[model samples]
Target: MASPLLRKPSLVHEGDATIVHQLLAQDTGLEYVGFKMIDLKVKARYEETLTDQECCIVALTGRITVSEGEHHFTGIGTRESVFEKKPTDSVFVSGGKQFLLEAVTNATVALCYAPSLQQLPTRWIKAGDVGVERRGKYQNQRMVHNILPDSDPSASSLLVVEVYTEGGHFSSYPPHKHDQDRLPEESFLEETYYHEVEPHTGFVFQRVYTDNRSLDETMSVEHRDVVLVPAGYHPVGVPDGYTSYYLNVMAGPKRIWKFHNDPDHEWILARQ
Candidate 1:
């Protein structure tokens, strides 16, 4: 069984405009990966110095000017909203550098991190450069956008991807788990799910469990919620009339993301 860990949206009025929500990390009981959401207004600036960890900044909405060392990216995102269904832009910077982002407009960004010493050159990933795939079928069908897939030679130990599911749909289906480092079957990876639901007020559901049913847990996931998957067969379901989106941040001893499906539910793949 798997015990799901969820963090609800931070309590802040619209007028207050939250700055950052630290979701998980070494200090917070997570060892490999860390996640956060950065919200800024026009001309607002945020800066951070990353040590011994590589980071990826994903724009959720609006545009921002990114400055890291001598590299600069202006207008980092073109999407007006997450529901735009358009591919968005993101930046990846190696550790031991300072990250500075100035909001060109009101914006929301996701920050993902993991330990690493290799200083890969920074890059601006265009929307079209991201590989996209329509996966599954029926209600389990979803779109997957690969950002920092393993094939990326510049990456050290981070794998980033985002999934979108239509309303009344299921994602991460068949209850897959990558808690073991056994190759050809599964490779251990620590992951974090940062969710954003269309309608903003709508919610989603997630089930994280293990084979023994000892750590089973189902959680009601609202907008801005973050779920930590230390080890489990995790799956998600979205309610009707509200689309679902989640950014996945992963890191592990091995950079590979091989996973194993629950044997009882693996047969569903044939139908898809």
Candidate 2:
């Protein structure tokens, strides 16, 4: 049986726009996070008014312009593909704002959302502003790009990031979980993973499981697939000859992120 947490891409036509995947928190039994990936052709525009959620618009590929009220941000993206290993541009839109996205070239954009009542400024995040880090070691190595981390304070509840794992490598490893809301210890965050594989035909494996073994499922994820992490420790492993890339969106009652690694696997961190 197919796991409910594994979401495959389905095209939905919205007037001139084609949404590759649209997921709401309610759809996944989550509380705060929601996601959408839109495909736009050259000169095509998509308009929306965010009534109760703040959004982070991430340009996955090609170039696009975002306009809100009198503010216009033009030519905001650069990379032609997610595998390019370069930081991409993103824009943060506050709640109750009306925004427009127009493609200067054929583009794919990701929208990461979280519920909010605060009306903050709509800010443009340039590609240069993104913080890139190389995380883990040996087989657990991966590249991380922090787009809208909790420390930024620009967002009320959403935390967005991009990760790249090489072939035969592991990511989100040591099997960490943030399902508890024990302040200063662990937080309760619901997350979504939008995955894309290099070469388009390859696949990766992701396991979402709890310590009690009650909610355990391993998924073979392909390009454009999404994995929902409602609760539990989630980790990703890429098979040999296939590189992996994923956009992560997370949200919870609080904006901070504190995680606990599985005690059984935490010993791996001691290895040089």
Candidate 3:
């Protein structure tokens, strides 16, 4: 759960992109997360100490140079990294604010600060490097992250990756809820969806609602439109005729996302 007082809100606007963030948590003492549109011609430097919380530094447009305690992580070409980066285990925390140097020609970067670190495993894989899996419908291709293997039930998560359909396909289909703390059933985690759409095109529909008489909300999202998964059966909907891409960042107390499927669509899980 997020602390209300620690919740800072803002709009991150750059050329051709806008990211709205509902910062549910922050570094132990820092109350505000950062959002900026920077330029390479001018070097940008930001420094802050982190509490127990973790932070995500995304190169919304170009590359960045990060210096942490006795280590430096270089992010090139619109790359991103968690402030407290974890290279192994798929789920772990470095737990610090650290410093960053952004030197992109013209770029917009989003910095997400949370109560703990949630960083994903990343490895560069070329096309044809591995056999592709046809796990989804529509034109969407599936390329599972090679770094993510089966983890312990007690582990924490950094990120989840999925390729969105080019023309109206579904990710997180059939609607499921991971808000409750259960044993091997569902785990509670807050998530962030970062998007990358095809040239001149954007995304469409995403629904978040509750089954226990809670109100539902449908949002028309575009590139970089971030939706908060706050205790509900949420589903991602891609409209017909446009290609989309996204990166999912998640973290919670349970450290696992155990879910209870809606009875209506429970059959889908069996197929997988």
Residue 42 alpha-carbon offset, candidate 1, angstroms? 0.4
The lDDT for every candidate, in the order shown, is 0.85, 0.93, 0.47
Shift in Å, residue 6, candidate 3? 19
CA lDDT, candidate 3, residue 115? 46
Instruction: List model 1 lDDT by residue over 1-272, tens digit each.
Output: 32338876664433424645686564357778888887888888888898888888888789999899889999889788887877789999889989888899999988889877587899888888989999888889899989888887667888999899999899999789988989877898989998889999899999888999877889999888888888889899999999999999988888988999999999998872
Q: Report the candidate with higher lDDT, 1 versus 2.
A: 2
How much lDDT does candidate 2 score?
A: 0.93
Q: Model 3 over residues 1-272: C-alpha lDDT tens digits? A: 43222222355544333435534343222222222223332355545465565544444445555565554555543334221111211212235445544453444444544444343222222222322244554333333332221252221333333344445677666777877777687777665555555543565577777886474777666765555565677666666666655555555564554777778876765663
* lDDT of predicted model 3: 0.47
Off by over 4 Å in 2: none
- Write down the TM-score of every candidate: 0.93, 0.98, 0.66
Question: For residues 46-133, what per-residue lDDT tens digits would candidate 2 score against the true structure?
Answer: 9989989999999999999999998899988979999999999999999999999999999999999998758788899888989999
Give the TM-score comparing model 3 with the true structure, all chains together: 0.66
Can you tell me which runs of candidate 1 are displaced by over 4 Å? 1-4, 11-17
Highest-scoring model, lDDT = 2
lDDT order, best first, reads 2, 1, 3
